[model samples]
Target: MPKVTMNINGRARSTEVENRTLLSTALREKLHLTGTHIGCDTSQCGACVVHVNGKAVKSCAVFAVELDGATIDTIEGQAAPDGSLNVIQQAFKDHHGLQCGFCTPGMVMSAAALLKDNPKPNEAEIRDYLEGNICRCTGYQGIVNAIMAASGQAVPAIAAE
Candidate 1:
């Protein structure tokens, strides 16, 4: 076992984990930040996306030992200190972006990262950016609408048949 220390959600945490322990495991099992979901261990699903040093990375693909001294931000850190939902989260709720909610954390994380880099991305960019995150229930229209609304863009109307 190796001792790894890092800043998680503005708090410094030190834990001993196996050398091969994935960051996702350390976050969920050790640090108790289960909001960072693990959908596909193969990295095909972006459910475990989290910010490492300000860049979103799939936690399932990274070892906890490899991120020593790094600053990690999980879905738990996205809300305000007073517990208010962030803009992206609020948008998701308001736009009905989640159904089963299994993928909401990852979607919100990816959307937050996208909005952080490109505050006003177009519809195509939003879709392209979130291609890695798969949601079986929402069909992604609501997610896209939420991301668009979070960026302050006008959500395009879905025409009636």
Candidate 2:
């Protein structure tokens, strides 16, 4: 077992995990951060997306040992210290971006990454940036609208929001 140390959700966390332990497993089982979902182990689904050193990476595809001493930001860290939802999260709720809520964490994380790199993404840009994430419900209209709204852009009228 390898000792993995990371700054998780703004706190220092260390855990001993097997070499084969996926980052998603270390997050969920060891660190007790359940917001990062594991929709598919094959990495086709972006359900396990998280910020590794400030970039979105599919946690399921990476081993915990590989990210030792990294800075990890999970969905749990998206809220304010006062527990208020962040802009992306609030927009998701306001725009009805989630249905079953399974993909929301990843969606929110990905949207955050997209907005960080491109603050004002158009509908097409948002759609293109979200190609890695899949939402089985809401047809992605609300999701797109949420991202747009979060970026302070005007969402199309057909959007759910």
Candidate 3:
């Protein structure tokens, strides 16, 4: 077992984990930050996305030992210190970006990363950037709208149901 030390959600954490332990496992089992879901172990699904050193990475694909001394941010950390939802989160809620909620954590994480790098991504850019994240519900219209609104861009009108 390797002793890994890292800053998680702005707090210093040290834990002993097997060298083969995935970052997702360390986050969920060890740290109990279950917001970072594990939809698939093969990395095809982006449900395990998290920010490592400020860049989004699939936690299921990374070992805990590889993240020693790194700064990791999970979905649980995306909210304000006072427990209010962040802009991206609020946008998702306002625009009905989630359904079933299984993939919301990853979607939100990816959207946050995209916004950080490109605050005003166009529709094509948003689709391209979020192609890795799959939402089985809502057909992604609400998700795209949420990202647009979060970036301060006008959300295109959605058709009436």
Candidate 4:
């Protein structure tokens, strides 16, 4: 087993895992970060999306040992320190971007990452960028609206003190 060290949600963590262990498994099974869902074994579904080194990545496609010393952020890390919803989360709720809510976490994370790179994305850009994340419910309008709304709003900063 190979040992891996990662900063998850600003917390430094280390674990010895099998070489072939997927990041999703490491997050969910080992770290108990169930927010990163395993919707599909293949990388097609973006439910297991997580920020790796500040970029949104499909955790299922990455091996745990390969991410040693990387910074990872899951959906659970997106909320405000007081347990209040972040701007994106509030946008989703305000826009009704989620129906079943199974895909909302991934969608929110992906959108948040997208906004980090492109703060003012248009509708087409939002759709094009979010194509990787598949949502069975709420279609794409609500999600798009949520992202659009969140794009202009400032995200809540995580408290360090």
Superposition error at 80 for model 4 (Å) = 1.4
Model 1 misplacement above 4 A: 159-161
Residues 1-161 of candidate 3: C-alpha lDDT, one tens digit per residue = 78999999999999999999999999999988999999988888798999999999999999999999999999999899899999999999999898788889999999999999998999889989888888777458899999999999999896323
Which segments of candidate 2 are over 4 A away from where they belong? 159-161
**Least lDDT summed over 10 consecutive residues: which range in candidate 3?**
152-161
Error of 1 at 121 (Å): 0.2
Q: After superposition, how far is residue 24 of candidate 1 from its true place, in Å?
A: 0.4
lDDT tens per residue, model 2, 1-161: 78989999889999999999999999999989999999978887798899999999999999999998999999999999999999999999998899899999999999999999999988888989888898877459999999999999887888433
- The TM-score of predicted model 4 comes to 0.92
TM-score of each candidate? 0.96, 0.96, 0.96, 0.92
The superposed Cα distance between candidate 3 and the true structure at residue 71, in angstroms, equals 0.5
Scored by lDDT, model 4 comes in at 0.87
Tens digits of per-residue lDDT for model 1 on 1-161?
Answer: 89999999899999999989999999999988899999988998899999899998999999999999999988999899999999999999998889889999999999989989999999999999998898978459889999999999998799111
RMSD per model, one decimal: 1.7, 1.7, 1.8, 6.9
Error of 4 at 129 (Å): 0.5
Shift in Å, residue 38, candidate 3: 0.4
Badly placed stretches (over 4 Å) of model 4 are: 153-161
